[model samples]
Target chain A: MMEFLQQRLTDLELFGWDEYINYWFFLAMMALFAFELIVMAFKKAVTWNLIGDSITNFITLFAYRFIGGLIYILFYLTAFFWVYENFSITQLPLTWMSLLGCILLADVIYYWEHRFMHVCGLGWATHTVHHSSPHFNISVAYRFGPLDGFFPFFFHLPLIMLGFHPFMVFLAEALVQLYQTALHTQMVKKLPRPIEYIMNTPSHHRVHHATNSKYIDKNYAGIFIIWDRMFGTFAEEDEKVKFGVYPRINSVNPFTVFFHGFTKLGKQLWEAPSWSYRFQLLIRPPIWAWEQEQKRKREAAAAEAKASP
Target chain B: MNFFVSALSTILLGLVVGFALSLQKAEPPTEFEKYSSANMDFATMSEVGYAMAAFGRESTADYFELKDYQEYVQLAQNDHAKALSASDSPQVAASEAQASKAEAPTMQLAQVEHPAKPKAKPSLKDWPKSVIGIQRSTELINVEKVWQEFASNSALSDQLDSYTVSVFAIYSDFNSDYSRATISIGYDKPSMKGEQQLIPKGKIETLLKPSNYGNNALLNAWQDIDYSKAVKAVVERRDYTQNSELTSLFVIYQ
Candidate 1:
């Protein structure tokens, strides 16, 4: 009986806690608590919904990272094996050319790749899972599947080609990931105007995740919000709006998630009139499809008027 | 008015002396007390006595101006040494080298156990003069190789840079005898200097990292080892680099 209990206890997830005394986890938790306390100290109602949402989000994030991290490791191992079988990695030059180029290129590629994930057909397949949830928090950040490996290969292909060792790329990627971890919170609501102009913030992110008609397909920035503002895709987050995609993915089932955007793309492609129409169905921004569907409704109404007259 | 002020001064002086004597004759604190007054060190001990006369137990203040972490480490070692002496151990604190008495030197000595020199200090002083110092260096680790063996080990790499930038101590025995110990870690930063304490009057060109050992286990992503192994291993690696006679190999720890 004792052994069974011990096994169950051992199976309990540590949230990567088996290492240090769970400093980062405690820090996140204390931050939430401190925020709640500030609210209570002012005698404001401690919103139970926020507390529930944070817990649900944290658990979701943990589950995804735990499972997805294992698969990511497996794929990375294969890549490592492939590298080892190829050549001696020693005496490789870690030059300024590769370092600066990889950083700027990675950032630029991340902007486009992420923007495509939010908009295009094949890219939307995996990314729609992130937008499915009505709530937004850090957990929503990691609610991704094991298939994220394929994209990074393309994004970081330059690292391998430039004789930059796989390790530098790996380290750089980890630092960027560690940064993205904090970006998914409701905390730090607004940044200073300079960083707001250049960096992604909760305000800009709220607009991205907002399901409101006017707010859809906007504010896409992986690191630099300037990309969105410059490209005319930016929308200032309005408080009246709520989170999640329009006609939400409502199910908790993973299958429904995996197929949502792909199904939408397929249906639109089938009904499209021309080759360009079909191409736009797969390649255009999600809002462009919404506009096309609305245009079809207007044309049908106009044809009805002419026939009746 | 003058006569009254003189009387008041005499009474105040008496009160102060009485207060001082009470403090000196006070009994040892109870088990619940935070520390023994004598263990508080000489300078703090005097202040504690003054606090006792002035405000008693409420006035608890302590300070130590440690120039380096070695002092705390030395205190722990010295305590152990004192304990070992009580058990009739062969070693005596007096015989150890004052300069080479820290943990790193002792660790280097521990590697080679010649029973004859059980209490004798290790002669790190006579080792290679070509590559001996500490500061910083950069090394690009083969994370792919390390990650293969221990991919699940997420402590270092989950944060995500494959190569660790680090620093190490370099020592060259003879022209061909070189070794390095990784001392620090940064990101993509190589070739650091000016962290060592001692600077000779001449142009002693020691760049915490010497061009030796080519980022062996010292700067390797697997930053695991005691100071002794690090010192000795770097020295062994340095020996090969000194063959160039002009340039020595170095390693960085991340």
Candidate 2:
């Protein structure tokens, strides 16, 4: 039985089943989203803003796929195969057990990567786009920033070094993303207690998307919520969630939605007092950068008044 | 309008950078090559040693054939001793003697070298006489017609039996000047193992010349192939050694 399963997995890996699964899941999500729109229409909640927002979401998705496709073909494949062939500690065979372990590990890695996106200035500059949508739906799950596809290389390449096949790692990453995509909805409030405790549900993800002070930077899981719980980043759904980033973008234009975070970050870096401050604005937390910018402005105004007197 | 301009400019810059990086054609380092490169730093040396040790411990299957950790450690020690012996000089020998007296057991362990083992080559008498070869360019070739022609010739396909065959296509970077072909024949009956032979580029060119395939238009069509395209052909025959159960020929040309 085990051998049969292993062979099946090997065949699946050979035939690029991961890509097929993702494509099928995408179609299913689109169908579900169509149903969601119908329900919204019945409830008299479907508005032009919501329609425009969803369209922008798909536009960002296409832009991301374009850049991502190039990077994957040109950079990721070569680098991954090179490292796996040369530096891997051992060549792990494709078994059901190994695949399961890889997916679990990839989930843990995603949790940290997701948390990094929330806390670090540069990560947030790319990641804030996903959370910028005022409405939460399946379409919002498709929303992506310009550099969203680039950052995973830093976080997941270690799996290849540790002997997991690059294809297996790719599949695991895709599965994690697909699982999270299913979480981006207002339709399902919560799952059973045990499931909500173990897995990342829509409730947990809604909390993650919320800009409320209590929910900011919380529940950064891709599939399993256990990492967030263990890392003290977990937050339970309590108050009504207010979606979108702080100081909202307030535009549904695809370009605006996609590039707003980076534009805001760029302006801050430009207005920064020194080269070191600009560097800090990149690596430091966004909130910390904002505080420093405010301090710098106050000091500049004080200096200007004294010079005028 | 600003967004479109910026996006296009960024993509153009990315394409330029990606193309430049791809042009370098960096090859992955071999095991000993990694160790040699790591010799520059103490931390890297330790890291490489640990990684190799870990690999030797974990991979003991058919592909790697690393028997055990002790054998792996002994191999490393032997390699170190050989290097020391090759570079020995009078002054170095004296320093080595002094260090040996100071650290006898460690010195003794480092100085022990094992004799290289002679590998037993399989006798060709047990192998099949029939050989089939195919050439492919960028354009697809009809492999079935070539196989039928070879089989009907009787000179190369006298053995009558069943078979299993696998074909693989290998393509190198367009910028790379090197072109070679690899042929491997394996047996599925558990008694015989596969062996690989690499045919050189010059030999391949000679075999595929137009004069060699006179009156055979199918093979002649591939004679005008460009060498700069990095085309590779793989010929595989499986289960042929079974004598009664199998006779196989497989070829991939790209």
RMSD of 2: 20.2
User: What lDDT does each candidate get?
Assistant: 0.45, 0.61
Output the worst ten-in-a-row residue range by lDDT, candidate 1 chain B: B108-117
- The per-residue C-alpha lDDT of model 2 at residue B80 equals 50
lDDT of 2 at A6: 45
lDDT string, candidate 2, B1-254, tens digits:
65345335534543443333233322342222121321234343333334433443132121122222234344435545654776642333334333433331210111221122222222222333222332322312344443444334433232223223222222222224323222222222222222222322321322221111112432333454555444554222222111111212222234
- TM-score each candidate: 0.42, 0.56
* Whole-model alpha-carbon lDDT for candidate 1: 0.45
Interface RMSDs of the predictions, in order, are 33.2, 17.5
Q: Write the per-residue lDDT of candidate 1 for residues A155-227, one digit (tens) a residue.
A: 5544444343454455445444544555665656888889888887778877887888788778766666776
Q: Stretches of candidate 2 above 4 Å error? A: A1-8, A11-15, A300-309, B1-254
- Candidate 2, pairs of clashing residues: B162-B246
